[model samples]
Target: MQITVIGAGAWGTALAIAASRQPHAHRVVLHARDAAQAQAMQQMRRNERYLPGIDLPAALTITSGPLDALLPSARAEDLFIIATPMAGLRSTLQALQGVPASVAWLCKGFEAGTGLMPHEVQAQVAPQLHAGALNGPSFAQEVARTQPTALVAASPHASVREALVQAFHGSALRVYANDDIVGVEVGGAVKNVLAIATGLCDGLDLGLNARAALITRGLAEMTRLGVALGAKAETFMGLSGLGDLVLTATGDLSRNRQVGLLLAKGLSLEQAVTSLGHVAEGVYSARTVHQRASQLGVDMPITEAVVALLDGRLKAFDAVQVLMGRGPRGEAV
Candidate 1:
């Protein structure tokens, strides 16, 4: 099997490495946008910048080239994983327009202006392609290190889900197939925004009781927005929804959570982002998530708080105040 992974960021490189380790001697190609980055990874046998300390598998082919060079060679049975951030998803899908491969993306956020999920962006830019998404609570560094990780292969198409399972399911990585693309995408995207709120809650030295309450309530917000967009309510209980929210909200390796932590420590938004050196999806998608929720008549108070905090309209303390001050309501999904 031939599997090509585009985007050489930490998540991209980690997935490429995981696929290369699959039993079938799968031909895995990891693409870097910059020729110099590709050369460096090739020569060093490591993605030093994004995935440090983990050696790239010798069987994995690292390439730097135009989309024409890569897409034209992809056959119908091959799989393409677009590992770029949400902002790059449109262009990446456009580049793969006529490719015969079953496609999936690793990004987890709405497009900034369109407020569309990854699958939505794919539908708009390359509706002709068979595409899905790979998402869950797993972190890239752990996956790259060959640790046990489980992820969802979400697509309305059965073949796409099977292709993903065949390519990535292994001892170190467990891939579960699901037909709920909308639910999976919504769960993955909204969790990032909620993670920021959780981080802020933790950074404020709030009690564990507060943290637990935030995660539970955050899941309600995610499920509401997801269902409003036509997703299955049950999907929120699965890996992409509740599982991902728990991990991203509490895990130290989470970049979105880090953004909130930095803010709580008194750093300005610019300083917090610049310090991370990586894209925190929450910082970019908070506003869009809030907008989409409002459009759907879904009340996402936590998302609104995150948007306010990110926009500098409210300080960390003030954001908490806003959330705590909301009128008491029945706990409902």
Candidate 2:
């Protein structure tokens, strides 16, 4: 199988390396938008800016060029993975229009202004394409190092799911198939926002008991919003839902978690984001998540607090107080 990953961020490069190292020797290409970055990776055999310590497999092809020129040779059996950020998904899909390859995205957030999920953007830009999402708890650095990780391949189309499994499932990577694209996407997007809340809880010197309670309640918020948006309630208990939420909310490598930690330390939001040098999706998506949930009549108190925290409307302590001050209700999810 021929797999083309159309971005050279940490996650994109990592997956390309994994696919290239497969025993069957599938052809893998990692495309970068910057010509210099592509040239540097090709010559050095490493993605220095992204996966600094990991070496790219000799079998992996690194390339850069116009999207149109590069994709003309794409065949129906080929697979294209868009590894760009959520903001880039629409333009990338527009460029991939009419391509025969099965497509998937690695971005895990809603588009800022439009508030559209990745699948929704794809539907508007390239509905004819066979597409899905590959998401889970795995971090890019760990995946590039060949650590054990599991992800879900979610799509309404069977061919998209099968294509992702064939391209990525391997010794260190387990890919599970699910047809719940709505659930999978809701899980992926909302978890980042929840992770910010968890980070704040930890940074405030809250006990593990608080951490555990926050995560459990956060999962309930995610499930309620997802179900309102046409997703299965049970999907929240699965990898893309609970698994990804726990990992991002607790893992030190999580950028969203880092944002909350920084905020708890009294750093301005700009300072925190600048210090990390990476996109913390939760910071950007929290308000949108809150908006969607409110529109759907779903109660997402944690998400609301996160949005307030991110927007400077509430201090970290005050946000916690607001959540803790909610009116009593029967325990349910």
lDDT string, candidate 2, 1-333, tens digits: 689999999999999988887787579999999999999999999998987879999899999988887788999999999999888999999999899999999999888988889999999999999999999998999999989999999999999999999988999999999999999999999999999999999999988999999999999999999999999998889999999999999999999999989999999999999999988888888888888888889999999989888888999999999999999998798
lDDT of predicted model 1:
0.93
lDDT of 1 by residue, 202-296 (tens): 99999899999999999999999999999999999999999999999999999999998999999999999999999999899888899999998
Candidate 2: deviation at residue 143, Å?
0.7
- True lDDT of residue 144, candidate 1: 94
Give all TM-scores, in the order shown: 0.99, 0.99
Candidate 2 backbone overlaps, count: 0
Worst 10 residues of 1 by lDDT: 65-74
